[model samples]
Target: MAAIVARENLTYKRWDFPNCAGRIVNMDEDLRAVGERIRSLMPGELSQRSLAERAGMKPDALSRALNGQRGFSSQELAHIADVIGADLHWLVTGAVDPRRVRIAARHAWDSDRGVRVNPGRAHDEELLGHVVHAYNAAFPDGPPPSAPLSDDPADMGATLGGSFVRKFGSVVESRLGVDVIRLPMLSTDYSLTIGSRAIILLATTPNWFRSNWSLAHELAHLALGHHGGDQAPGEAEELPADEFAAHLLLPEELVRQHDWQAMGEQGLARFLWETGVSTIAAKNRLAKLNIRYSTEVAVALKQSTPVAVRADAGDERGTFERRRAIILRQQESSTRAMPPILAEALQRRVEDGAVSPEDLAWVLDVSVDEIDFPEPDDSAAMAQAYRQAFENRPSHADLEAWLAANGKPAR
Candidate 1:
């Protein structure tokens, strides 16, 4: 069957789902369901003809898609939704109103004082206004909850990452009404700021300090109207964002007094644990103080904070272990809800015979399967499965030559 293909990089892949291991998002499965929705709306004798005419497809092609005999192409589904007066988003997710998703496809820019832009990014003044408006609406008041404004930004662990995480990821959620994910991993300089829906995703799970820093970094991109556009961002924009996040996360006065050399390794480690400041970030602050990393100091620091130990003689679990336990529990107990649009779309695919019952069952969360059926005669699927199989297929002609060389006649 024909499949709905997503534009590369535009859609998230399946692995992006809340599994901590997942890294991206995609929308192919969701579009497949749109075909079902189209078919569902087009019932009766003349329905196929009506849909075909509206979508600019031949009646036979539409019939095949509706009957699950073939898949609708991406172009066909998009056009069909338009003809049916369905929002493209509705076909994709059944969640968004058409009016809400419609926006001019112009680059965001402003020229009050004539400034070069990062292209398609916040180049258009009007688009910037909408984003700013959304941001303002979410942050009508001052900044959402954050680590308490400290007198000592340079105090090793003086800041709480949990507080900052709660601010952008939680308190901000109350305002932006979009996804704000916080992941735990060692990868650095990683984040996704989807300007379209005000979505901000942060993946910095390995070190809470760095995760918190990345959150501020991504937030800076969103708030400063840096969309990164289609091109790799030049330092012209990135430096400013980095500066914004640094100022936001590390106040000037406190950073000014951070005695990097004097604090030494143990001091730095304790400060990091307390403030959620990663060593890399600490290095930068230290660089200003002319403080460099020392192996002896590092050893002292590592010895300072073992896996899990009692901060106080009364605590049962080590601080690290406690945090670990909480994370593990959260992972095990928390289930990310499937977007209603995706759920509906996949369900439609099943109903229209485009997808198999087993496939549906595997994708679903619960034991939703009741009755099972024989596997489908997915000839299209099979052909697609083997589309490139012959790329390295053994050559029959070559095989015959080899046999002749061995004094064996070809059969």
Candidate 2:
């Protein structure tokens, strides 16, 4: 068989096998390149045999493919890509799809001994994919400005004010241009980055402090550029994110300014209330800074609840109610079925006929009937409008004659 090797678009190597049924084949070089890419994507602890088992391929077959003795079918490649959380297009073509959105989250993957596995990753990727698509379609110019509000966590925490817990999400959204969505069904928080823009999905819970920490943690992932399954032994990525969240939520400078070691449970409660961080988070932050509290104070702080903390902090009934109202409002804003910016964009797309109401409803995770779509103009009205606009324009012959009559000479 005569084989003619060629390169297309500098993407992949192709082999034209004219003598054998005229079917083109990928060159061995391309196959080896793809194998190398897949190897690079796999975690250090994940063996080829283990990956093959997870991807439902025979060990020998995978080994052969990896050695460039054979090529993987499209289905096989897709299965392997899913197993490793890789982009199949990138694996095959060695080119990243600019429109592709990558989601990263802690505790999404786990390694049991030497075996790598994904535990309870949930529907984060699928849901975030829909959001990203809707958002991109709605705003082709890309998401709002994504500049960092401040590089220093202490400045960020201080600038957000004492109500930073309630204001953090909005600040992240408006200042960082990160779309923050709070979903009651999500098991954990997720960060989805598309180019420079990012979307953070916060899992809603009654504990607003924990929710705030989760949001800040996800923002940390974005800032550190950690994508899903990119890090082996997930803890490597988690520690930094947690540290970032701690600093952002409870600035070290603020913590050091107060004598926390001597401040009993009441003062600890005050700190929690003021910083909007959970008891454990505050404790960890102190431990990280080597600020030790008495054993009695530690026990009291740990045993305290939000209600008890509020009361101990000397909040009056009216003040408590006001703060409670703010928390409720913040939760409501964060837990919207769809993010406001995304919802607006989707609505605009629907109005402009770029997207369907059914699609919008599906993306919003609501029934189509529940959505209020604008009344579309009648076809006759649209036709009339087009006809009027067309009638107002000069004809091609008239424009040519006018140009000939008043044409300017070249300088």
Candidate 3:
């Protein structure tokens, strides 16, 4: 007989069967144990009724199940797990799946809220899982070439130049060893740290400036160690991320070097063109530094478009047209180009038969028919060798005599 012990706390109550040795002896015990695990996952502020509503289950039924008075169906458990962002396997088996990618932070533009928000949806989690798995399979020994960036935002900003701004995503991937993938389906940018490596996913956008800012913001989250929770981050987390990005793009010392108040609109335009940041970002950075700028010029710059700013900055006509064409092409496509290292890794996995061509196509945002899979390897020789080895194996009588001589049992 197992001794059932009740453990009570301010937030929840659970039963611990000390003598059961982690075994569920009966159906009743199994239901109760599962219920306890679910209850423990719920936030202190969230009630059982609220959880049921989120999971689309009847409040009474959920309450009964949670109280160990009724059983929960597999469908109901799955719904609950999805709603709470809990791993279904872990909820059922009491173990975390190592293959799944865990997001540290997610930043997305919320039109309704008119701010960047972090929803932490389950679909994003699954997509990241596929990416992280492919990355690990490709580099089983360790990550590719890497150089750690400076922790100080100002120092880092001073080091990065115009070339880095032009190829922000690629520079981050190759130099920082952070995998950067741009997918149109994602509404948010995600940052994940798996072991010593980090991965960043950006929502596809044609605006190069916005994409750069998003990348920098996700990098800031990683640098600050903001391993996010199920809930959206408030001002405490969002403010620092924004500040870090500001310093990274426009170092305060560099900003102070120029006489912004005297340069007027043309000077502001040049600053914007040089820094590769939006007007609002530049305005805020100035405000933070208490650097006075002409209100008239600031307003005019804010109203001006990116193209107008480039023209005002006196960029070459041919260069401007070429950049515009590139931006137009980017806007037309739903998915951006994959990082070169990531593409190489996925292709290697396909060749090794560790992943299917269909999987590669999905990750690359292309059709499976478009993928060119390598020809199947010839296994005839290997099969013959295996058959010969099997035929030359020891017989059962010889194995029995060996076991007897070794003082081992033969079942």
Q: Over the stretch 1-411, how does candidate 1's per-residue lDDT look in tens digits?
A: 232334431222243344545533323454347567665555466477877887777898666556544555667767776666555555656544312421222112348645433353343444334333333333333222222122222331233333443333454454334344432221223233322454443433433444566556655565554542333344466656556666666555555565544555545544555444455555555565455555644545444232211222224455566567436433422332222323444455567665445444433444645624445579977886788686766699989999999999999
**Candidate 1: segments with Cα more than 4 A from true spot:** 1-162, 165-168, 175-178, 182-196, 228-236, 257-266, 289-411
Lowest summed lDDT across 10 adjacent residues in model 3 is found at 5-14
TM match of model 2 to true structure: 0.62
Clashing pairs in 3: none
At residue 356, what lDDT does model 3 achieve? 77
TM-score for each of the candidates: 0.36, 0.62, 0.60
Model 3 per-residue lDDT tens digits across residues 273-318: 6676777777778889988878756675666446535545345885
Tens digit of lDDT per residue, candidate 2, span 99-171?
5567776564344464323354655556656667777777776665455545456666656566667577877
Inter-residue clash pairs, candidate 2 = none
Q: What is the lDDT of residue 319 in candidate 3?
A: 62
Give lDDT: candidate 1, residue 227. 45
Question: Where does model 3 exceed 4 Å of error?
Answer: 1-100, 106-116, 119-126, 136-148, 158-163, 228-235, 311-335, 374-411
Give the better candidate number (1 or 3) by lDDT. 3
Rank all candidate structures by their lDDT, best first, as comma-separated numbers. 2, 3, 1
